[model samples]
Structure formats: structure tokens, C-alpha cells
Target: MADDLRVDRMTEKQAREELARLAELLGEANAAYHRDDAPVMSDAEYDRLRQRNAAIEAAFPALKRADSPSEQVGAAPAEGFGKISHSERMLSLGNAFEADEVREFDARVRRYLNLGPDAALDYTAEPKIDGLSLSLRYEEGRFVQAATRGDGQVGENVTANARTIGDIPDRIEGAPDILEVRGEVYMSHADFEALNARQAERGDKTFANPRNAAAGSLRQLDAEITRARPLRFFAYAWGALSEPLAETQMGAIERLSELGFVTNDLTRLCDGAEEMLAHYETIEQMRATLGYDIDGVVYKVNALALQARLGYRSTTPRWAIAHKFPAELAWTRLEAIDIQVGRTGALSPVARLSPVTVGGVVVSNATLHNEDYIAGRAASGEAIRGGKDIRVGDWVQVYRAGDVIPKIADVDLERRPEDAEPYRFPETCPECGSEAVREEGDAVRRCTGGLICPAQAVEKLRHFVSRAAFDIEGLGAKQVEQFFADGWIAEPADIFTLESRFGSGMKQLKNREGWGEKSAENLFAAIEARREVALSRLLYSLGIRHLGEVAAQDLARHYQSWEALVEAVDLARPAAQAHRAGEEAAEAERAAAAAEGRGARVSEARARARSERDVPEDAQAAWDDLVAVDGIGPVLALSLSEALANPEERAAIDRLVGKLARIVPPEARAEDSPVAGKTVVFTGTLEKMTRDEAKARAEALGAKVSGSVSSKTDLVVAGPGAGSKAKKARDLGIEMIDEDAWLALIGDA
Candidate 1:
């Protein structure tokens, strides 16, 4: 322990400099890993540096800082993500890179919890998928939004794309109104290959691996694109919730799964180190077949109550450890080639590699990507660039990419027989007899079959009722696919249209071979419940290109009527002609004078107009007027008016809204309001307040009340000992004002 840490004895100046350097290094590594699943440093190298930094902070406890590199997680949330004050701060976990470290971590957890000598501290272990972490927000029984873990304080909104995943339920059954579930959005090896295959066909660039594919897809500028990708999510832990959940980690996971969130079935609860290690072994063994990429297994204290009691050390929870898997290599033969059609109508080819083992998991197949990829492979499945063609009966080298997928590395040309020939790909769809056409500048081929392909149809149906989309329960991806395969379902409306042979559509639904009465009833109820959703959701569910949650929201607020929205969607006139046809400020002013018999400022005329383009002369006046609102901007205004100009969009919106519920925000959106810029830290007891009250007050006052005090904190309101928070504020030279001071500053009320 002594040698592992050696920094306390240093001068404060040296400590500060060391801390700064550590911050930079960790920040870069975190960004590289989170923003791009590409780690800048080896796990060991990162662990060594982290340990050194922790030691330094421990040695010089007085020099310890709140925003120190050792305490921070990733880079401060990137701008643009909605900032959320976690009910419980989102902390980083302690990493154990070796068996010894794992043992030490085990020791520490027991020591902190005061466990008996023979006490069994079983841990639940799961493969930690190497992907971006996200916080999913559910309000009033609906999946409302999702955000990235920006800086523990803020997160970027990726809710639009998150809506696409079928595993994530938009509305969970038997859950509190407000829930903040945490999960990892990842791509399976199969899905990743299929995605890249499609990309290749389109001549678009491909990601290096599944992790990159998952990260890049989720972070897309357009949520519609994200919706198109076959990303998956598995909820592990949680952040803030309107209410408390089960007492144990496994219990929480079980509860999540029951509530409709997808959970990793591989998770296990071990009773001790031996059992934990065994569980880890089991997980490592299933790595390749697991589909998604997992760099390591995470062992966390099972009991939620126990976890809270163990508390945290600095920024990391003391009750968890990440045990990584060792990397390995093997070789397999290339066999049949198959193409799978996706819900988005994209076609992909999969290589059936002969069986082998990598990192304990058996590898049976790898993604060949596209025609270009196949042409680049040797007859022995090795790269033929200046090299051979990938053919049947050829042995190909396979290696672990993050210890999850068995990726093709090269081919064993020396072992190849003269009988192997180039594997021929199909020129038409395997599922539907549609001509597979390769669009110009594409690497992948498309089954031009559209809605006729069974695979695509089922996939699309599953997407329609996905947790992130309409969140229609009872009709899950599997059930939808099943019904589609059974010929009981077809279009999106067929799900609702399926009549029950029995009573209330339940008995009949239940009378069906696969569905029980209760299950059928429950599903019918859920589907019926969603018959009327919000205009934005209905628009998004239509699966239109270049249209997403944000755009839908904007359109919804812009028109406020379905008739208006559909009218805009169908606009056929050229934008330039419409732009010139709209009313101008000058004409509006003259009209106002003529109409009222007395003319005022151009502002007066503009104020009377609902939109700038309402008048035929000088529309800029009204445009400027709309831009004056807090949330409305020039870009949004232009898009709203231009889109509204189309009659088709407006008409569709009208019809859709007729059957949907109005979405009213909790409150009006706040822009450059009072709470926008300031950081406030509340501490200790308040004579007339609760923690929630204080937080609300600060937020209402246009201030960000952070969980911890740091140099960034502008005001620290202390009531009593305030302990670490107050002291940290003082040490950092931040202003320390008492409760009364805060009240006086905000207002007497």
C-alpha cells in the first residue's frame, strides 16, 4: 500500500501542478474512451497513473481539491446537453486492473462495511460494454429524454436517438412517475457488421468496431439517423428516480427488466471472492456469443442498502470494481455468406467463420462487410490487397476486439487448399425476391423491396412501438416479429386492428397460441392507451427522414395544430418564391394604418402579425418580432414558417393531432433567465428549509446549485458545520454566505 501511493509529502505547489497534469491526462483518456470508445492509454498505464494521483491526494489531504483530476469524471459535460443536477451525484468507479487489485478492493469493501471475518460479500458481475454511458429520463410513465454523463452536473440530450432502441421502454409498468435510469447504448457484433455493410454499400465510411459504431450512431447530429441504427441498451445502475427501488443491485436490475428496460441476462450474484471469480469466468466464457462488445466485467455490491452504507471514497463508489478479461487470438474457416435485411431497408452480409475460440468465447462468424471487403480478402480469407479472394473452406485468423467480438484479422493462406474458390455474393435479396441494387458510390447493396420484405417489415414494426418511440407495450419487437411471421400482423395499424377472438380483445389475444389471456389483455390495453400520443411523437413515429424529436417539437410548437403542420409538410412551391411572397414590414405597417385609420411604429404593425411572412411586404419585421421571444431564434423561426408553408405537412399534422394528446411541458422553457450562469452550493441545515426546497430556490433564482463546492462555485450558503462543502468553499477562496445571506440576496420572500 505504501509503495502504491507516494504523493502526500510533496509541497502544495508541486501537488497543484501534479493535480493539473493528472486532470489533463484523465480528461483526454475519458474523452477518447467515452466520445469515441478508443482508449488513449493501455488499461495498465491508466491504472498506474490514477493510483499515483490518488496517492498524492491522500498524502496531502489538506491540498485535496474538489475539482481535482482525481475527483472529476470525463470532461465537463460538453455544451448543448441539458444540465441535470443528479439527485445523487453521478460518481466514477474504482478500477482494478489485476487480480491483486481486485483482492485489495474486496478487502476495502469489507473493511468499510465492518464485515465479520467470515462474512460473505458476494458481488454481482456483468461485462462492462465499451460504449458511451447515458442517463434515461422517464416522467409520468413515459420515456421523455436521454442525456450523456457530461460532467456529473450536465449531460447532452440524445433522447431523439434513444427513442429508436426497442429494448429501452418508453413507459415502464409499475414504476414511479419520475425515474432516471442509467444504461449503456451499445451495438452487437452482428448489428455492427450489418450497419457497416450497409455503409459500405452506400460508399459511406465504416466504423472500426462495434463500440465505435455504437458511439458514433448515438451521437449523430440527427436523431432520425440514430433511429435507423440497430443500437441496443442494457440498464445496470440508476441515477435519480422519483422514488426508491428494491434494496439490492440484482433486485434493482430485476425490477428494471420487469419494468421493460433490457437487462443483461449474464449478470450473476456471487457470495464471495471465489464465487465472484467464478462468475467472472462464466462471463468471460460467454463474451463472443454475447453480441455486444464488453471490455471487462464490473463487480458491484449487490445490496443497494449495503452500497449506501459503504458510501463513497472521494468521487468513486467504494463498493465496486471492474475486472477486465485477457485478450486472446484464434483462427476459423470462412463458409457461407448470408445477407440480413434491417428495418431501415439496408442490406448486410455476414461471414460464417468456422468455429474457434477467442478470449474463452467460441467464435462462429464475422462480418464480411460488403462486396469491396470480400474482394479484398484472399482465397484463404486473408487480405488480398497486393494479396487473394475470401472463399469457402478458407481458414481466417480471428482476434478479440475489446474481448467481445471475434473479428477477422487475416487468413491462414499456407493451410489453404487448391480447391477453395471465391465466395460468390448474391445479386438479389435473400428474404424477398427483390433485385439488390448497389446505388452509385455505395459499398453495400440494398434489397429495393421496401415494405414487402418480411424481415424489414418486422424490424420496422418493432421499431414503431419501441420504448424510445411510441412505447406501445404488449407489442414488443419479439411479439411484433412473431405476429408478423405468423401472418397475424402487417402494417403499424394492424397491431391495433387485430381483433380478439375472445372478450375485450384479451381472451382472443390470449386464445392465440403464443399469448396468454393476461398477456394479450395487457398488450391490447397498452396499444389502446397509445392510440393518442403527442403530435411530435406521432410525427417521429411516421419515420420521416430529416425529421426527429427536436424538429417534431419545433413543428408542434410552431403550428400547434395538425391541420397547419400537414399543410406545411406538403408545400410544393419553391422556398424562394414563398420567401418573396410573404408580407414585408413596410406593407404590414401600411396595412395597419389603413385598417386602423392611424399608423404607429413598424413594431406596432409587427406585433399585430402572428408571423413575419403573414404580410406580403417586408416580412423581416415580423421575423424580427418572433426572434425576440426567449426560446424562439431566427433559425427555428425560419424552419417553422418554411415547413408550415407546405400544405401536406400541415394536413398530416392535423390528422395526427386529432388522435393524439397535447404535450404540455412542465413549464415554459427558460432561456437567458436568472438561473442561467451562476453556480450555487447549499450546505448544512436550513432553519426553514429542506434540501429539495433549497435546490428549488436556487434553480428558480437562475443559479445552478451543484452537488459539491469547487472553485467554479460562485456562492456557498452555509447553515451549520456544512463540513467538507463549506470548508472546501473557504479553502478555494469562494464566497461563503449564510442561509440568511442567500435569502436576502435572492429576495425577502
Candidate 2:
């Protein structure tokens, strides 16, 4: 489906499928941009896709995927660098594309703080730097470590490389004993040009843009390479401070500058949305002359107190937003169209374009989304781009806004070649000659080839070793592809037997074109290191549909062990299938009744379907328990059950499990906390904190917070306007308390 489709017009099935596609697309985009420093989609297109995902989620809240892009930050840290867990999460800022969005942001701040329109609120507006995010840690006023913002919670250590930058201060005279300065590491246009020229002169690959150059240069394993690069820093934020920097945002920036750290000189203090927008315009006007790349303007609540009160969401801060500039457009010729199969067997189309410079980067390809998109219609049959279909040999307008690759914005039909014909989308998988089918309510066509398709097999193997999964140090995508082609590592279990199979023989890895003895040994050691993996990592590495990092973690936490999880899934499978069958039958009955003009029969069929779905009590209970975990709805639960029930998949899983040393459970809960190991529920309005804050605090205290009141609930904390849940708690005779009493009980009051 086109990302621009209206959420209200979409059916629930369409919304679910779109969300899954967006999650996969955005996940890949995040990895490309953050981990590899090679983005595959334009920033504008990325933002639009995220917005569409969010809108669909909001429209159908229950249908939201556990791996929704809205809840994710940067990709996991790339291998080769030692990892660093941030003292505080390095969150991404929310974006505002229009003037109204900026205004809405301000209004949201006011509402959250319970302030009116007339309240005196000020903001700090600065250029949103287009570069890599870095965090510098200092203890006793001396620099100690620097890290790249990998995923919000963890990062890649680059201390030695960071020390090579001239702008970074090795020591500060008067600062907090422990401080973490957060900012952007950027390359100026002049420096980037010189570096690229030097690279070209030396017969090395030139970087695409200043941002990419800066990121690649900073992440280099060799500190000398980073020293040679002319990278600059602009300290704008701080994390994990022993003492407060200042009372306000502007004051903090001033303090940072006083400490010998380079801060953005154009940072300005503004009051209200009007002034913020004015500064945004001023920054945009000066963008070309700034020397450094900045894609937008950032606005932060000036008062630190307000910022603290506003708090943060899962992936972004509520107290700040990035007001993004519009995309830069350029005309390019569409040369051809190509179809690529993803791990999920979706046959995605790509538009090959004649090389053109867009936003200082050369563009050769753009995502076609799906066949519906190429045909100029959304899944709902809505006309997009004025009903102009994209074709090979047509002149297309491409645009770039942020870090990713450029995208085709519009087609110039007048410039189309006379002999160009409408492209025929293939009905068969190009890689395996298998039937490619588009299921009902699905926009993208997928191959039915399964593991037989090399493309799908390779992509799945790549996902299994991705940074967030197994993450073997020397076993990356290239190696996985090579091994797959050689038929030495066809499945997850095959990976564990590499050494025994080819360690010392003539056909060993060390004998390969690029491999040495040391490298081969290192790869073997890395694989050995992952033998005793965490249950969450193991689950994610399986490449199950709809089971992402977060969902896997959730399941791992609930099930605790691999054996326990498999048992639960096995017990729940029968009931899950029964329920699905009943639902499908009910849907068919409703459609037939509606077609025959029997409205009463439709309601009767739905009631009968619900009765027919009733399975044995034990099986139904097991299915209920499986779905009871937060974020594990019927869709994800059913997918899990089906995956485990498949003979081929289950056999592979069992083989992989047999090769492992152990699957570690999650860390133990906070034993000393008052709510440790207890399930708690919160209801109605919270006066002292937001619901999110309450939930976070509860979880931090080792409590299992539930969304609904049930027999398992140990306590309920009800506030003003408490209704159904509060009543349910009372009816069940579960212990209940008001917000104040609850706080006092937790020793926070």
C-alpha cells in the first residue's frame, strides 16, 4: 500500500500488513543509516513512512505491532567496536514537518504541564545537525570515554577515535565529577571536499556526503585515521551528570562553551511557537553558509524544570522536537525496474534511475513500495501523484531531505520516451521460478518458494547474524552469503558445526580467498562465544514473522526458558488454530449473509462462530496464558504457535537448540524493592506523574505492571476518576490504595 493512504479508509487487515511492512522497512533503514552509515531511503520518505505507521497504529491501537517504528531509536551498535551501555538512554527527538506541528508541540507541552496558553514558556532553537550522535564521558573533569548512539540504551565505544578530534576537550577545569556530554560529530563541507579529493587521489573510495564521511571517519577502528579526518563537534546536550549544569537550556549551552567544548553559535532562545518558527527559518536561510550540514532546526523547552516534568516517551523526548526543512528535488531518468526478494519472501520493486546529484549525494535507485504503487494506486484504489504511473525510460523527479537515499517524488509524463511500455510485474519469483502470490488484504506480492529461494535463504541468514541477533564478530553478511552459496551453512544449526566440518581440512575457511588462519580462528571463536546466548537473542535470531527484538524479549521474560516456551506454544497451538478457523468461517458467513440480504443471519453466524471456537478448557487456558503477555495479541500469538507447529521449522529449531550450551533467562528482579515480583495495576488520572512515568517507576521497582485488572493482580493503585478497573479490583477483593498511599507505601512520598 502507498504510505500516504488515509488510515480511516483502511481495513484492520490492511493496517496490520502495512504496519509489518513499515516495521521491516524502517528496521532495515535504521540499520543502514545508524549501523552501516549507508542509508537506503531518503529522510523525508523515512519520516513519512514512520508517520504513516504511527497513524495506522493510532487508528487501530490493538493492531499495533510490537516492532512498530514509533517505539524504536537507532540501530544496534555495529560489531568490531566494544559496546557501552549508556547511563541514560540517548533518545531521538520527535520531528515536526509543518508550522502547525511546531505549534502543536508547544501546545502539547503546555497541556502536559497543566498550563494555559497565556503561560510564560520559552524554548531554545538551534540547528539540527546532520551527522553522527556521540556521547563523551568525563570523570574528575578528565575525558574518559566516547560512544556512538547505537540503540538508545547501548552504544559503540570510540574513545580513542574521539580523542583525536581537535574540537573535543581532553580536560575541563570546573565541571561535574561525572558528566556525559552529548552532541553531534560533523564534517564541514570544505573538510569533506578535501578528504574526498585526497581519497580519490589515493585511489580509495570517496564518501557520498559530509555526514557519511564524518560517521565513517569517527567509527574507524584505527585512531590515526580519525586523527587525519577534520571532524568537528557541537555539544548541545548532556546525560548522566553528577550535578546540574544550569537552570535552563540556554544556560547549559553557555556553561558547555565555558568548559572549552564547542557549542553551536547559532543557538538562540525563543518564546512561543512563533519565535521558534522564526528561528527555524533563519537557520534554514543560513543552512548553505553554515559550512556544516544541518537538515532541520531543533526546539527544546528552555526551563530545565519543565523538561524534567515533561519527561520522555519510549524512543523520543517530549520536551523537544526537530522542525525539519522540506526535501530538495531534482529531475532524473528512470532507467529500469528491478524486483528484490526480502527474507519474508516479499518481492519488493526498485526503480533504477540515471545518476543525479540530490542533496549533495548521487542517486541511482528509489523504492517502488509494491506493484500497487507502480500502478499509481493505493491499496484502497486512491489515486496518488495525480494518477501518474511510473514506467521505465520516464523522467522522474527525485528528492532528498535527510540522511537516507533520494526517492522519486513525481513523474514527468511529457518527458517519457514514446516507445516505453507499461512495466509488467512478474507473477513468478525471478530467483527461484516459484509462484509469487499476493494474499488478500496484502499490498506486496510474496514468493511461495520458502527456503528453496536463494534470495530468501540468504536474507534470512543475514538476519540471523544481524547486530541485534547472534552478532558473530567476523561472520557478517558477505561471509554468510559466501557460505550459503558453498552449501556449508544452510541453516542455523550448520553455523555451530563450521569448525568441526572445515577447521583443518583443505577446504577450510582459512583457504578461502580473503581468509587467513587468524581470521578463520577469530570467526570460530566468535561463534563459540554465542553458544550460550540469551533466550531473547535466540528467539530473535530464528527470524520468526512479527517476532522482533522487543517481542522476543517480552516472550523470553514471560517464558523464562526455551523448553518452557516451546511447551506453552505446543499446548496453545491447537486452540489458536481452532479460534482462527472459527473466525475465518464467521467472516465467510457474514459476507455470504450480507450478499444474500440476510442481516439477522449475519449476527446469528457470528454468535455461532464464537460458540464453535470453544475448545477444551486446558487448551483454551494455555492459549489465554500465551496471549496474556503484554504486546502478545492474537496475531503475534498465532504466528508463534504456527511457527513452532511447522515440522520443518520445529526440527530446525530443535537442532539449533541442541547445539547451544544454554539459553540464559532474564536478569533477576530488584529483590529489595517493595513491589518486587508482584503484579500491580494503575487506573484513572495520575496527579503527580504521567501514566508512562508511573509504569516506568513501577517496573524499575521490580513490579510486573499489568494493563488490565485480573485474578493475578496483587494490588491496584487508583486515582481520581477511577472506574471499571478500580471496581474490578474491589470486586476481586485485591488490595487497593490511592495514589498518595501507594507512593507512601513505595517509600517515595
Candidate 3:
């Protein structure tokens, strides 16, 4: 938790700064987990950061940014899948972290209903399955569609994949003609283990947890891949219904079970708050023995009438609350502190701890986050761990909650060594001996050594060859590390020259300690196989911060050719530079006009200067065109421009490109496609495809995907939750279509 950033004591300036940091942190976390399926932080850490953001926003509402994570839902749908807008929004639940909080939830619900202190309330309590949320839609009692809970309002259309899950009833008689059953798609413990074993046998990727396994399986583009996985589902709620299934929540669950849906057997009817807590405890106790994972218990007001009366708050329903279990903690010795450099050169401090068990996982390391965390101070200078500094040889409490990375909770002063001193973070990169600088407003201290830092270089090289990137066989993490250490490979381009340099030499790689003749040949063949790669893969392998797989694909589709993309980047450098210079000059002119006591004329002068100093038409067009592409905003554009402009980086990229046989552009969109050559912008919540996926699909059909609506936009795909973009499109007289219409236009309907 950002417990150290005391919201109540924060100044407006501090609150604003903290809010921005929290927004970026949480937003990245959401994207990593939801879109990339590679989470950098634990759910607990994410929740804590979210809670901190909420606290800061509450304390300084006037300073809240428009894109505050508090206003957002899940990560935007990734590209490649068709989107599905939900008939009824899949809302998340409010969390109660303790029994007292759970009691307070009950009290709040009772107060909302105007119930007296002695009044009793009935609730339905069940385990909150730790799995991917799914909504199954049935038309005329026959399953017709299934979707993920993307951003609550819109999800990915995974109907074909959902059909493979045995627990889902393809046809349900005696149910509403139009029904949407909402629950979780999960992998049981046994199934997860078996699946992992199979993956290992096949030398494929293994899942970190059952939840991720289930989600990855269900989201497979190829339904056959999803069908090969063992997946199950449970019915806990209903979305749209032609008729009411029952009058109460418990009754509805029973009806669902009767309709061939698998409902949790541990679900119980609680007479009051005490019974609900009891059931929560019961579930918590049985969590270990259960076949699947569950992080908490969900308690809902049993009466459907009461639920309707209670209604929802901004994000979650007031009638229902999730009582989350406390994080598991264990005492361990603080062995040492180590700073690790990430791809972006951020120096993260890790606590090297004596091995300890927390929540069935053995953890020997914990995250200290940054200098402030190590110093036990919040950004606002508030003390965490009661001002106790974690020291080497100290017995510290480490905790893990909901599959999050282990973190130090507190230090036991009683067990601290007398000779222990306060740990000092390094001022230089340990690997390169270069200055490590912490920029203003940033929690992380980055290495100024840049690519020269071996730590950063190795990390980036590892990322370049990661499974999602090059996926070069025989060149895994260990191999990458070994080659980098031995000076055999220092960058991506070096891999292509490996065989030519050492294949037939007397000191060939075949004569290395771990390499045999056959293994060396296989490695060279793997490198050769990847010499002719796709433009998207080549761009993604560069490891530019914030340029993910989805963004790379978007760029590939937009530019169509590797040469065109590089030329555009080269053009964008001067264009962006000119734009910045013009903006600065305009600001200066405005200031000079104000100083000259020109009141109303100051605005006029500013406008004139802005227009006169405007970038050249070609330059402006290049910059505007770059930003106009869907998912390619100013931040990413800046990174790409800077990377391509830097001499060393540009040379590296050029070398790599020169070595490649060819960079295959994305497949051209069909000439006969309805949306071909049209400019389309997707706004609000998309039901059929995620915004990214929608953009991809449009681009696939030879349509130019724009992020915002303009007069030039030929069509606007507005979904259920569309807001200002839709209004702008309407005002501009742009043709509008729903997600269904867009899907039909793409011939996917």
C-alpha cells in the first residue's frame, strides 16, 4: 500500500504529483495484466496503488487528472480479437479487507435501506473464484455468444472458444429465451497441473497460475488451441434475461444449477452479517483444499428486490461486497539489498531475504521499490513501517497476497543485529560504474550509462530474444547471459553474424563447454530461420519503452513497409522538433505581448506568432499523420523518434536491418472489402472487438484507423459507452455505425 503517502497531509501540489505517478503505475499494471497477459506487479500491489489513487483523488478532487485510473475499468481489449459489447455491464465489486470492513459494508447497506440497527438482512455468500470473468449469451435457450469482461462494458468475442468448455451448457431448456449467464471461466488445480505438464512435455510456455492459464486458453485466436485446454465455468449471476429466473439471488443460483450450469456448492444463505462472516471464514479455511483458487468471498443481498433498491455506486454495486483474505506473512532475515536495472534503466532495489514460505510459495526475495521505500518514507515524507528502516541482518516480515511478488511488511527491531547499519543505495550503476540519476517527479533512479550499462544491455538483449519477440531457439535467457558475458553477443544484430564469425573456426562455438557439433548447427539454423522476419516482430524486438506488440502491429499495418516506417520516423524527428520550436516561440511572443501592456491584443499577437512560426506543411503533416494512427500517441511517437534519431541506436537498428533477408510487411487489406481505404475511428466501449482489436481488424481490411473522429474520418464505430468522440463524430456529420455494423462491414458477422 502507498501507506506512506499520507493523503490527509498532502498539499495540492503533492497530491497532483502523486496522482499522476499512481495513474501511470496503475495504468501500466492494468495493461500488463489485461492486454499483455504478463503482469509486472501482483493484484494486491495493484489494488494498493489503486486505493492510494482513490485516497489522493478524494483528498484533492480539484487536482484529479481526467485520465485518472479511478475512472477507468479494465485494460483496453488487445488487438486481433473481435469485440463484443455486453448486453448488461459486468460490474466489479467493492472490497472489504477485514471483518470490521465487512460489518461496515453491511451497516452501510442497512442504512441505505433505512433499516433500524436491530433489523436483520439476508445475504448469499460464495467464494470469489480467482479466474477470468466470462459472459455467455443464449438466444432462444441456445448458447450463441460468449465474451470476456473487458473494461466492464465491452469484451472480446470468444464464442467459438467458450463452446469447448464442458461446464458451459450449449443448450439450456426451461431458461429464458434471451439469457446471459455471467460467471468465471477457470482451470481446476488438477487440470492446471496436467496442462503445465503437457506444456513442459511439448516444450511450450507454462502458465504462472491457473487463472492466467484459463484466460490465455479462452482467448486463443485459434479456437482449436482453446479446445485442447481443460477449462470449466460456473454460473453465479445473470446479465440480460427475457424473463426473471427467480425472485432472490439464492433462488436464481439454484435455477441456474438446475439448468445444467455448475454453481459453487459452498454457496450459502446467510441470515445476517455474522453468518456472512462465518461463511467467509469457512471458505477461507477450505481455500487450500479447494480444486481451484479463490482469493476472497463474495456476499450479495439475497433478495433481488433489495439488490435493485440498493443499486450501485460509481463502479461497484452497494448491495454486494467482496471480503478479501489478509495477505500471508512470514518472518525472514534480511540477507542483503541488491539494485536491479530494468529495460528502461530504472534501478529497482530488491530485498534478498532468507527463504520463507508465504501462501504456499517459497520466496527468497522481496521488492523494496525505491529509495523512499528503503528509507521507509512515503513520497509525502510519511514514515512506513512506523519509521523503522530495514537493515541487513534484521528479521523482517515478508508478505504475499493474491499471487503478488513477496514484499517486506515490517522489520522486527528485537531481532536486529547491534552492528547493523542503515543500508545505502548506490549512486552509480554497479555493472558499468556510471552515475545513476533519479529524475524529478520520478520514484525510480535511472542509470545514466544508458546502453553502455551491462545490466541494461543484457536485460534488453534478453527481452529482444524473449518468447514474444525473436523466439530464436537455443538462444534462451541463460544463453543470452552467457554470450553477453563472454562478449560473443552484445546486441540483437550480433546474433545474425554468429555463424559467419565462429561456425568454421578452430575456436568455434561447437568446441565450447556446453556446445556440441550438433547443438552448434541447430543454433545457427535457428538464427538463420529468423533472418527473414515480419516488420512487427523486428520493431517489437527493439525493446522501446511502451512500444508493445499491439502498437508494433498497428505501426506495421499503417506504414505497410519497413523502409516507409523508418523514413517516416526520420521525417518525424525534424517535424516534431519544428513543432516544439514553434510552440515555444508562440509562448514567448505571448509573454512579450503581455509585458508590453497589450491586454486584448496579446491573444491576437500569440495567434499570429503561432501561425507565422508554424511548422512547414510537410513537417506538420508527417507529425500529425504519426499521431493520427490508432494507439500511436505523442508519448510513443516521441520514444520512437528519439530512438531512431540517436546515432548509436540508429546504427544498431540499421545494422540489424541490413543483416535481415527481408522485413515482410503486414498482409494487404482486400480490395473488395467494404471499409477498404476508409478512415475509421472506434469510440467508447466496443462490443465486437477491443479498440485495439477493432483498429487492427479495420486496418486488416485496408481501412485507415484513426484514434479520434474528424471531418476526414469516413466512418465512426461507436459502441455502447461512447462519449465525446461520438458527439464530435455526429457534429462533424461523419457516418456512424455500431460494433455489429462494423463487424458486418468487415464480413465477420
Rank order (by lDDT, best first): 2, 3, 1
What digit string (tens of lDDT, one per residue) describes model 3 on residues 1-749?
Answer: 23374788887887887888788878888887767667666666677888888888887878889888877777778888899998788888878888989889889889999997688789999998878888999999899999888888888889999999999988988888898999998888778879989998777998877878888999899999999999999889999999999999999999999999999999999987899999987776455457677778999999999999999876788899988765476566788998899877888999887554355344668999899888888876899999988888888877874456888889879768999999898989887888999854467888877778889889989999997689899999888999999899988999999988884752657778878888988899999999989888888999887798879988998999899988887776766665545555656666677688665455655664565465576666788899888899876887788778878878888899999998889887676788887988888787656676777677778788888777789999888767557767866788998988777777751
- Decide which is better by lDDT, 1 or 2: 2
Q: 1-749, model 1: which lDDT tens digit per residue?
A: 12222464566787777776676677777777665555665555566778777788777777666666677776555444455555556676777666777777777788888886479776898878766788888888788888877666666777887888887887777887788899888877777778989998786998766666887888787888988999888899888777787878998898988888888888988886767777776666555456666767899999888888988876788788788654465455677777788764567777786444455344677777777676774433566544555667766667767665656667667768798887677888889988888754346677777667777777767777776468886667777777887787776756655654334645445667766877766777787678766655665565443455556555555656565544443342233234433334445566667788885666554544434344433344444444443454544445456544546544543444454445432223244554456898888888878876887556545566688887788888899747557757766888888888777776733
Tell me each candidate's TM-score: 0.44, 0.50, 0.49
- Output the worst ten-in-a-row residue range by lDDT, candidate 1: 572-581
The collision pairs in model 3 are 82-688, 82-689, 83-687, 83-688, 83-689, 84-687, 84-688, 85-687
Model 1: lDDT of residue 525:
76
Those runs of model 2 whose alpha carbons end farther than 4 Å from true positions after fitting are 1-206, 210-327, 400-406, 505-507, 586-614, 671-749
Residue 167 alpha-carbon offset, candidate 3, angstroms? 0.6
Overall lDDT per candidate, in order of appearance: 0.68, 0.86, 0.83
How high a TM-score does candidate 3 get? 0.49
Per-residue lDDT of model 2, residues 398-468, tens digit only: 77534465667788787789998988899999999999999656798999887788898899899999987
Lowest lDDT block of 10, candidate 3? 354-363
